[model samples]
Target: MKTDDLITVLARDSSPPWRFRPVLLAAICGSIIAAAALFFAGIGFRPDIAEALGSGRFLFKFVVTITLAVTASLAVGALGSPAGGVRRRGLLLAIAPALLAGAALLELAAIPQSQWGRSLVGHNARFCLTLIPLLAVGPLACFLAALRFGAPANPGLAGAVAGLAASGIAATFYAANCDDDSPLFVMTWYPIATMLVVLAGYVIGRKLLRW
Candidate 1:
């Protein structure tokens, strides 16, 4: 083709590229909805959900998970944009962890040292590790799919944030069935499981999120 014709064609096509944030949001929300439905259908809330929700420990579980989800979601949205400034705001995700750490310390302070081990171990150590990452599958997959819509400067970090969001969603669902309401359990095992997901995200993002 002639240069003039090529230039004319290129100039004529000046439409904006598709927006990534909306796609990311939809994918994340859709995945969460699907995961929640599956979780409820397969493993509904604990038998004592009414009583559990009323308890301070039970309520705090939701607080931590929701905070992580909120902050990570914000970071994910920012990272999805090509403009690339997630670092500044991404630190906010630490709020949930910091709060949990503080609570864990307070719990340690109040309880006898002998029982600290039991509180950390809880009743669901095996199950907690298995189920949280298991539940994280859907949201992680969806977040990766969403990342495909945009160009992130650091795929690993983007993936990490995605993992964080997924972990939060997964933990929230897990909370419904988990009978162990100890802050010590949530603070310890939950973060462990979430970090596993984040590592998985980092590895996968390194491979898949590249342009």
Candidate 2:
């Protein structure tokens, strides 16, 4: 075979490469597992879980808030990707999540001294600090995976996946460590801190995974 033909064959055979799939799969699975574990650990299928679920109002709000924030971050990051050089694209992706997370953290902190306010601050701070390691782990995995496999065709999707996974892992830790089981606790503080870390992941993914 001619050299050009051989090169073409090689490229076709190893398109996007295979080495990185395991890491990406692992990151995706790990995040999902972490979220499920936290859900079970937090309330199980017990009366508390049922009661919390029964309060349809709070449950609806919680789901909507978490879903929207995650979706929005991913969308924003994905939409901003340019088709050429890496520098501008990388910076834009990094900035979006960092700004979102920082803003969410600030919003959480800015609440006044009511009972809800105090609980939000206390729980969120504890959750944030504890999940720092796990939060860092998802991005590390993503960065390594991206380096080996090249950037995903859809960065927003990657960002969303990474964000959810990071949040889920952190939430699991929060469930295991935190004594508070109130829906109010989950609704108020959990989403806020989760979004912050997700934002961090988005920023990191953009910078390190310059495809």
Best by lDDT: 1
lDDT of 1 at 1: 100
Candidate 2 clash figure, as a count: 0
Q: How many backbone clashes does candidate 1 have?
A: 0
lDDT of 1: 0.84
Off by over 4 Å in 2: 1-14, 19-21, 28-150, 154-157
Candidate 1, run of 10 with poorest lDDT? 7-16
Which is the leading candidate under TM-score? 1
User: What pairs collide in candidate 2?
Assistant: none
Local distance difference test scores for all models: 0.84, 0.47
lDDT (Cα, tens digit) per residue for candidate 2, span 1-211:
9755754465446545354545455544554564455445543433355455555433443343344334433433333223212343454344434543554455456555365555544544564455534543544354335333534444544554455445544454344445454444555566666566667656666665555
lDDT per residue (tens digit) for residues 2-113 in model 1: 7556544543552336577788879878768967977977778889998887798788888899898888878888887545557777579888999899888888898999
Residue 141's lDDT within candidate 1 is 92
